[model samples]
Target: MTDLIEPDALLFNPFMPGFFEDPYPQYKMLRDEDPVQNHPLGFWFVSRFDDVSALLKAGLSVEVGNLAPGVMMDQLDSLGIEDGKHGVLNMSMLDRDPPDHTRLRSLVTKVFTRRAVAALEPKIVALVDAVLDRMAEKGSFDLVEELAFPLPFAVISEMLGMPPTDHARIRELSGTLVRSLEVVTDEEVARAIVNADIELAAITRDLIEWKRANPGDDLLTALIAAEHEGQVLNGDELVAQVVLLYVAGHETTVNLIANGVNALLRNPDQLALLRERPDLAGNAVEEFLRYDSPVQQTRRITTAPYTLRDKEIPAGTFVLACLGSANRDERFFGADAGELRIDRPEARHQVSFGAGPHHCLGAALARLEGQVAVSRLVQRFPDLAFDGQLEWNGRINLRGPAKFPVRAT
Candidate 1:
């Protein structure tokens, strides 16, 4: 569709229908024609692999406070996203710069270490089986509803030792809250996000208070007890971290399983390969991450003048490091970068979980979940196939299928 139009106006427009469903074509154009795009909106788009990698680890600031007075702030201001709104979005370590980021991340990093994640293998296997068993009962089902969505939600809830509550309501609130991370031109959506954040924060506070009364051997309890230099996470900090963990813990992995299954089914050979060799489950998850990243882009504010190739992004500018594009860069991943090869040697190097200081803390856990979920899925139902039309979730940042109808038998 963009083959005839000017690339500058429409190229990175996630609203475009074709680009929303399949963004690779536009991504390829950006990489080929303009690897570093200086958007008119006071932001820079870095599409190349090396440049993206550099930008991520270039000591850039994730905090919006570092952004110089610019159109970006005006954009946010226009949407009514002021200081007090979007509470968890602002407070989480994902939005913090160093010292604070280091401190906040360290509080829960050990829980997601390789050893910790590995120890959850048996539990993960059981959980996956539990969901798959339900799927088996219904010969055909929506993959998202049946297996992909519920598994991670259960795991995260269990890890946090959350009391049994209304799952549907929380999922609704979370789905709305995450929209804050994506492109929001609609004031309605912006307000909805703010409202969701408020509601979710209230729910989280109540949960934290409940945990305070009845402590347990779980992450929420640990966060409640965590201290650094005699300073514990105060009320707001505790709420922010717990909310971040709850949202990030399940949402991305939901996309991972759904997207991984979508990719494998689309590539019959890869699905067959996974079925033939179950041992490839772990590595296959990495390849799946590379093939179609659940999280497409991560943003950072330039702290200093950042030069990439020949382009120098000025300090305090918003730079969108396109991880999805970088993962498929031909220059780095070879000529078949667009193709899915489960055994691809460089698959593990994909920046789907990102790199540097703000790299995803739940990478190990997500990998384990994806490995188990995807591997057991195809193995259990050898004839697994897409049963109906697929619908892309209209989210630019966390892009995946919203409706994934599939045959389990």
Candidate 2:
């Protein structure tokens, strides 16, 4: 590979701060000209919807953690932190391959079924109303803080049997963990690792111990008691599962709600349509996920040499599936690909939640949260408008607003 072209031109440096401010342009260029661009760093960038979808469905790969540990190790090294033995948070069923993945997913699938998620709807609605009530009194607010952040926190917290008082503490810790996702200088990385380690260890240990002793009627307790006759989650496995659920369950939903709201704010006509027809809220959330997904990109590695779209990707090459870009590819989505339209017939087909076996476990929970949060917010504040310049979180893989100030009438 005689260094085909400038790495910068083919693969955008997502670690850079400027990329976060605007990745769409870079993504558009890649999708148009280099759908399978080879990067100098020995990875293939897949930006088209069909190509990315095919790769995901192909399933001839390992999870990003095992395959491209450097992706994470480099992140950890940059932060001056010694990585722990990779555990469940990094090894959920979603992260594992075939047999193991199948077993692990089967064990946890019962807990997140549509019926189970539906049971939480009433509670979710209550949480949304309570948050909106407070925000209504203020007349203006940051939706991320006042509504988007806490709604999912409450829903997931209760599901895991955590107390409401711990919501603030857990939310703070989750924020710190998410910040660690941004590729930053060693100093910042060190701070993030220390913060994440302390908070995650303390919270996971405390909750696991409590669930062990008290034996509550919550997901944590159930996971603790779950077994396959002789097989069960070991101490570390149990802890990792809790940590995974805590982080994935809430962090992504936070982005979904925030990103969804930001999408509506940016598209006033769409916002008006949603305001007038709350029935479209569900479909609209799907479109929002496609337009600005919470998880922007995911990595995969080839098990052996493979040819894709006329390019040969060797073993050990990291494949970056730019989901955010793929969702807007004109070939799959047509001319209005980038536009936010609830009426679009193909909006539901977006790969925002991903495809294949690793599709988000909490997709149902996220959808419920998004629908309720957006519908109620729009209904309560029909005149909601952006009140200040939006500040985006500088994270490569997560697309969301850091601060979305809005005025509600």
Candidate 2 residue lDDT tens string, 1-409: 2133354555556653366777887889888888898866556789999998988887866565534422343344455444553323455564568777776676677665778788999999988988888888899899888888778877888888864456666667766665444333345554655556456766787777777887777887777667534375544655656777788787888888998888888888988999888889989988988888898887677888877888888887778888999998989999889889987878899998888877778888999999999988888887898999888877778778889899986
RMSD of 1: 3.1
User: What TM-score against the true fold does each predicted structure earn?
Assistant: 0.93, 0.90
Q: List the candidate 2 regions with Cα displacement exceeding 4 Å.
A: 1-8, 15-18, 66-89, 164-169, 176-191, 194-199, 228-230
| Top-TM-score candidate index | 1
Measured over all alpha carbons after superposition, the RMSD of each candidate to the real structure, in angstroms, is 3.1, 3.5
- Candidate 2 least-lDDT 10 residues: 66-75
| TM accuracy, model 1 | 0.93
Q: List residue ranges in candidate 1 displaced over 4 A.
A: 1-10, 65-86, 110-112
Predictions in order: lDDT: 0.83, 0.76
lDDT of 1 by residue, 72-144 (tens): 3235456655566445657888988878888788877744457766777899999989888888999999999
Measured on C-alpha atoms, candidate 2 has an lDDT of 0.76
